[model samples]
Target: MPDSIAPDALRRLVLPDRVHRSLYTDPAIFDLEMTRIFGRCWLFLAHESQIRAPGDFVRARLGREDVIVVRARDGRIRALVNRCTHRGAQVCQAERGNTAGFACPYHAWTFGLDGALNSVPHRQSLPPDFDLKDPRLALAAVPRVESYRGFVFGSLAPGGESLVEHLGPIAAVIDNVVDRAPDGEIEQAGGVARQEYRGNWKLHHENANDTLHPGFVHESSVSAARGDPRDYAAPAYDGHQTHTQMLSNGFGVREWQSLSLTGFPAGHSYMGGFYRGGVLSPDRDDPVWREYRARLVARHGEEKTARVLGEDRFNNLLYPNVSINAQYQQIRVVTPLAVDRTRVTAFCFRLKGAPEALFHRAVRFLTNLSSPASMILSDDIEIFERVQGGLANSEPEWLDQSRGLGADRTEAGGRTVSAGLSELPHRAQYAAWLRYMTAAA
Candidate 1:
């Protein structure tokens, strides 16, 4: 592939079981992805709970666009471009806060929370024909915004699939998260943990559900946990969640093969949970989990609670930019800074009526998996950079994704399932990538 990729050339870049290396290294391809993939798809923005009150807002990224996700006084959530319409300066600088309106720093042109032009610095200086109500003078708003079980998403395109249609069956994973709460609600409790890596953003999603790499890429952390008896000595130990989680990644070949991985047509996928007997395990009977279960039972009854707690999916990827582990109340959002740079922001949720200890466990899970100093994520980040560095070479122009290509079995719901170690998720993502990259813009 050349530096300048045409729409027709994109199909040849992504094959049945291999993808061209230029997809990761080409600046032109990355620019096209920003407009076609991220711009058209419904990218995850802010959780509804994050901005529950009127005037509350948080700065977010919509592909290459900086946006402010705000709740207006009329109880509506709106995403507005952060740039000032007057002088092209950023209108909001804060990460998150509550305010009545935003005033541009370069000039005093102010806008309402809904991105409506409210006032100008010097109204008399403007021509009499200039109207304040002109839509072009206000901040640019994302064309479409929707929420599914409180997880907000925005699309830059004016028309496309609705959020529900786009999510397909993956919405059930989100439902499991919210349904686990006794009050049927979850809120963003802890502050976000962000880490920047020197690699393409696609690498994160590619590695998210790859069960085979954990035993190799994260061997140091997994071996350390395996060598420590404290990780597995006690069944009810609550403090060793991180160590136990590390140990879970050290599963043998047979154990990994026994697990199941499923891929969707829309680029979403998830793997069956591998943690069997740790505090992070769904079937664990620790006191904190017992209390949490009892609370859920009180609200949802025995059968419903069992169904909620029975879900065992992990690393649910929502296409281009989001990975959710609803079982642990964790969400990681990936943002592409450049062709070779990416940022991941992670947030943990608190079950509205569950015990505080459960929320603490969720926080610990988030830290162990996504924090800058995380044992697992640091290793993955190092490998991502190394992959990026290696791809700088011109040889080996194609990356193989045929690990388990011929063995995928389609289930009743149109999802393809395979052995856990298969690279089906990568292929699924590329299928969607090709569709978006080749579509008419």
Candidate 2:
């Protein structure tokens, strides 16, 4: 641990809510998070759909290193460093494409879909000791890469728990994400939106579950054509208003009491959101909607299906990488480039075998309504940026996250959860973060 750990790092963290500002503002700390947390953790790599066919590929970063995920001719997926063995040139320049093989643009060295060395301009001219069978000549696969449902993740460390084990309780949510479809799958549709934020990447992760900021922060959307959820939830029980912030907006009101905050090892947390969140459209006579609800009710019963569709979830951080709102068909990934700047990519998934319009509705909810381009998203981004700027102030010695004190709950596992709005997820994140930072490399 760094000397700056203020002897109070432990005391600085109060469970179920509140965290030290250092986890957000300190550069040294962010560096360690990138390694111990992101490096060791199963970081989101790409959707399996992104590489569905032979030679299809997408370049994703694990921490700061670039990795290329490709599908072999046999339809198996592989993730390997993008770096070329010859002079370390990136083997593939395009972000996404299908290819028979990848050739380094710098030296024209080629490799097959399996990342095997294919050809060199002058292979025989090279030294006899240049063994093509050597692992160094072929692309180096990442230590660990796996998919949960269709969501993919890459880890630099090999010894951590398997992807499913790390997912813990949220596995159900992941299943819920796809199982909503009659075919039990979800697909990337309507493309994706990428945005850069001038804040620590963790801010996005923390903010993913941030329920308190929506009503106050996203005033534009809340104030516009569809009045904000806060205003809507306040009095009239209209069923048409979009929850907009949905689950994350739960923090605005202090209804965390009686809620559960389930934190798992390796830093993941979730809690409950009331069913009366924002608004729900009356179940219409659409065939797909009818089938979906009927199937859900059949399997989980009306109460559970009602629970699933009724309230928005507080937020579920996928840990060190992705945060997903399964109910909303949204997943956001936070990629850190520096201590101060982070890029977030948000994607909306379509329920497999569902009506075409259902996916379009989700797209509208996300782009025009939820994401940064969305009026509410714009405001939320503003809030995150303001937090970044405010943290730079020399005026305050430290920042405070103390909220819902003494409310966090520890479960059967070494984890905790509190009210819907508690900052415990942030605290849990930092706790895991600290463990990673101080852990032996």
In model 2, how many backbone clashes occur?
5
Per residue, candidate 2 scores C-alpha lDDT tens digits across 1-441 of: 433443345445433344556656778777666666777878888888778888889888898788888999988888878989889988888888899988899878889898888888887889989877777799988888888888888888988689988787767677667656645677777767788878878777666666566667665445463545465446633223354334333333655344456666678766665434323332445675677687667656788777666644545777777777676587777789888888878788887766666676667666754566666666667778898888787655555566655776677877776766677777777777666666665
Model 2 deviation from the true structure expressed as Cα RMSD, one decimal place: 4.6
Maximum-TM-score candidate = 1
lDDT against the true structure, each candidate: 0.89, 0.71
lDDT of 1 at 11: 85
Per-residue lDDT value at 137 in model 2? 91
Worst 10 residues of 1 by lDDT: 274-283
